[model samples]
Target chain A: MGISMENGLSTNKSVGKQSVLFQNPPCVLGYSSIAGKKEGEGPLGSCFDIIEEDPLAGGKSWEDAESRLQKKAAELAIQKASLQPKDIRYLIAGDLLGQLIATSFGIVDLEIPMFGVYGACSTMGESISIAAMLIDGGFADKVIALTSSHFAGAEKQFRFPLDYGNQRPLAATWTVTGSGAVILGSPKEVKKLPEDTNPTIHITGITTGKVMDYGIKDSMNMGACMAPAAADVIFHNLSDFDRKPDYYDKIITGDLGYVGADILKDIMKEKGYDISKNHMDCGVEIFSKETQDTHSGGSGCGCSAITLTGYVFKKMIQREWKKVLFVPTGALLSTVSFNEGNSVPGIAHGVVIEIME
Target chain B: MGISMENGLSTNKSVGKQSVLFQNPPCVLGYSSIAGKKEGEGPLGSCFDIIEEDPLAGGKSWEDAESRLQKKAAELAIQKASLQPKDIRYLIAGDLLGQLIATSFGIVDLEIPMFGVYGACSTMGESISIAAMLIDGGFADKVIALTSSHFAGAEKQFRFPLDYGNQRPLAATWTVTGSGAVILGSPKEVKKLPEDTNPTIHITGITTGKVMDYGIKDSMNMGACMAPAAADVIFHNLSDFDRKPDYYDKIITGDLGYVGADILKDIMKEKGYDISKNHMDCGVEIFSKETQDTHSGGSGCGCSAITLTGYVFKKMIQREWKKVLFVPTGALLSTVSFNEGNSVPGIAHGVVIEIME
Candidate 1:
């Protein structure tokens, strides 16, 4: 009855209403990214660890292809961390599939304790936030946060089939066929890291997002659907930490695409915070409009995931950016829900990653 | 780089592996359960808050009905806690639908921060484990862990349509048409509880489960598929805590029906710990085999959820059970994976709850 000290940790890290400030930040020991052929042709192709030309990758189905991508990414992540899969205590992962089929079928062989999470495209941020909390809370020594998505697989499930060959609207973004896995380790585990490598980047804080529905019914325009949520989290983080837009090198949103990015800027401006000068969207950064022919940009669980594991993580390791807020936005709607005339709801989770110099 | 104490908490609660011994356990302040009419006729029917005679609940679709169940359960939980929807910081919920439609559409009106999770039938356990962690880690002062399932909705999605009237196999369990929600709060919040209420129950510890594939390919026999994983977590909990089966008044497995219960006991027996005497399965407890026509028993996310919120919590409050080990097992497979001849993998999450005098 006296504070119930039986099993609770003695810490007061809860900052505001919906954010946590980790006392002992979990370090990103290593990360891996696997992209499909189309993603390989994108601007960040050279940044990915592996790019398989064959979407099927010898598998019989598109779902299997996605599973293979998740496996490769997880394996590569473990290998980079110089730790076996058994050394990692947990695998927090999900995919853009019903029941998280890609994750279940993909990383099943690892046999690590898993917490299957779903935040749509915001899965990467959600996974990392949960993993960091577990590590910082002393629940795990090392955890792998991973997520994946494939174009054919996502399209068939979320939209039209390939055989239909329906023309997509200009506001639609292509699902990035890729997977990304990041290994988060405790401070003790980070000390055991190889001396030859640069200083590890730590996940210092996280702000969990809520489902924000702006009454957008068009599933194709996910960017527009998700912008408000992204703006909401961005505002909360800035207010919670009492920091301005320039507090970090960049304020990155997951897959808002071109259309959603503009909407986010407008929303932020209305909140008295103008982040347009230093804002970047993973969806917009992954593809080139002139060559890729993607109508809007790239969007999926993998859009933010691969971009972070490949482009953002590398930049941090090289000290190009000291601190950044990574917010992955998700459109929470299903085909059945859309068919039933339900509006798409959006969610965005924010993670603050910084290099400990 | 000295532990990066900036914005980090100070505590170490992780014990051995795959488990966390909360130093200051989070208390379950309030809870609510809503079951369909079919469930109302079951053994624990009288314990539920609302029992709707119509499965449709005046909704247009089965999916809408499931959503209504979730919304009602969550609303009732908040009301029981003497709080409004805005008072809750986060809502962690999930279901067995594609993209978690029930949770999204159902809880959209509450507009709280949400983390949609999926562990098949084990979602209840997963959500509670996560919510407890968030509270113990000082991430949220009050968080609601909820999940739901509908017999009609699940059958249509996982099996054939109701119109087909296809005969189900003996091993297939009936999906419970219900929803359960538990509000977990920090100690400070628990002190504000109604004076006449009994002492709050606390989540003492948790052991996360790994996906264990025993090469089970039959989805209908979910108990058989999930038994091994259930055994793995049970054994880990016993080993990690160094306690025998008698350590708790009841060792509850979520919904491994008649067949799966035997499998779990057998698996535990092989590990030198026999739980045969104290074991009770929620699936088997909710129904009277002779009267309820449910083949094996009740199963689904709601099966364990409603059982805990309705029957189990009541017993704990009455001091009928001093301690409990609630392990919810999930068969991690999808219709697409099953059709592709893939084997089903199983997972289980264990949470230890106790009442302190």
Candidate 2:
């Protein structure tokens, strides 16, 4: 018999988006990502590369690496904003350490008030969303958002002890082992929020993912593993605001690997909402090569954070895209669940990005 | 044999008062604290007290209690502020989990943008200081400062494993075992920065604590543990402003126990600064022999948080006090340190809280 979720939590869609309307006084300050040593220079494609040597093994512990990531990200954001340590009022950041403990302690020495946040891979959009809200809400003069992940750290906490043996199941999705940060503040001129921003992407709506498990027969395909939750959020986001696929320039989801992406597309079409113009998942984008051979895309909190920082933000700044919906998904399960014979349950949250030129 | 701290560490003082500073547009609307159990409480002292029983005795897990504390604190503060969940810009709260995982996951469902903060026991004050700064700096419209601590949670993380049979020391201070939350917003008619508020009690000074091995030390006597740090800030505040004890009405430290409070008075007197008329502490005030002998006073994140919420804040509203300095002290030792037989060192950050009337 397959193991079932004992809690029987309803697996549903979860996505929240609040629009800042038209104000874009803030600009992207700085961005950075740290790939654990084992994370090779390039993204890993499939399960076969899972056996690569531990990248963080030779250097600092994953905690140390993450610590460095926090400092670097903050420094870059602060420097880009042309602010001193004391100048920024708050640093809002988080990761998937079950509660972002490392990022919290690591930033203490920076001598700034910190707001730790977590949304699994959705953290990038989550941070930006909150930063935007803070800006529009008039709570802060400036705010910084950051997130990071080290393979060793992730492995120790989620899957196997750094020193333990592991196997790559077809369903075992890859977690983007990286960190990213952004800074936001007001424009002195009382200018409108960025309009060219991601598709007038005001988060006018949200539908959070729920604990869901549709009986994964195998642990190898996370696309299939997290498809339902993704579909749920995508479907809900559209319905909640009386929106359709055409509302956003692009609709994005955090790493869901190859299978989940296909499933999402299928689900969208099935629901009569076609987002064909632009529908992407970071999981699929990060491991586009067969050589990387990641059965799924990079997973973990860093998955979305790094992608948004490295790809989405840059793309947005260059006016390459506007009005994008960012939804980072997570399969909230511990190694014990897999070992205990539980099909992984999934959840995802979305935030819209808009830049008013 | 005795505690030794660096020179002039605590001599930090407040920034000068500037009357009629511009008020940020958003202002704090609501706040609440949970000292005991609520409907679905976690550990005692924190807002969520459902898990107050001993975790070692099979009561509840720290993760369970800690997460509940964060959620409850945020919820209460949100309710008090009369803001919708989406109306909040961020949830900035954190505690001493392996990765501050408790608070991170706790707010996952709240759906507001988040900024996780960690300053150990000082988290309470650190959160407020930054929230205030963020508001004053004009960064966001709304910011919530929340923190929580459970006795069982603290014991396992800071002192001993639930099952460990180590001899607890008297000097060791008990964690405040509670949760408190406050909201900072861009006031519609923003008040001047911290010392500028009418009848303002500016945070005259602040001194972060360093780990000093006062040979006679353990975790219990945290007030005693942090007395020196308090002395430094007291002196620094005096020196920074070159003011005497009569500069303001009151000076209060966050959660230094009775022992620490006494030591601070002595240390300040020796320095030719006498703040004898009005000085208080969270540790010594939150609880009494009748409430629970807590040895000397309330200690932990909740100590300062609750003290400010239940005592200091109400007192301000009552107009019985003005021009007060609120210093929230923290002991930075970790569970590893206790295991290594290391004496706990401390730090205290200060913020000036006063009535605008």
- Report the number of the highest-lDDT candidate: 1
User: How would you encode candidate 1's per-residue C-alpha lDDT over A303-337 as one tens digit per residue?
Assistant: 99999999998888788898999999999969888
What shift in Å separates residue B18 of candidate 2 from its native position after superposition? 15
- Tens digit per residue, CA lDDT, model 2, A15-108: 1232223234454544544444334445432211122244443335565556566666677556654566665545667666643544644565
lDDT of candidate model 2 versus the reference: 0.58
- DockQ (C-alpha based) per candidate is 0.44, 0.10
lDDT score at residue A43, model 1, on the 0-100 scale = 93
Fnat value of model 1: 0.60
- DockQ score of the complex predicted as candidate 1: 0.44
- Candidate 2 DockQ category? incorrect
**What range of 10 consecutive residues in model 1 chain B has the weakest lDDT sum?**
B1-10
At residue A123, candidate 1 shows an lDDT of: 98
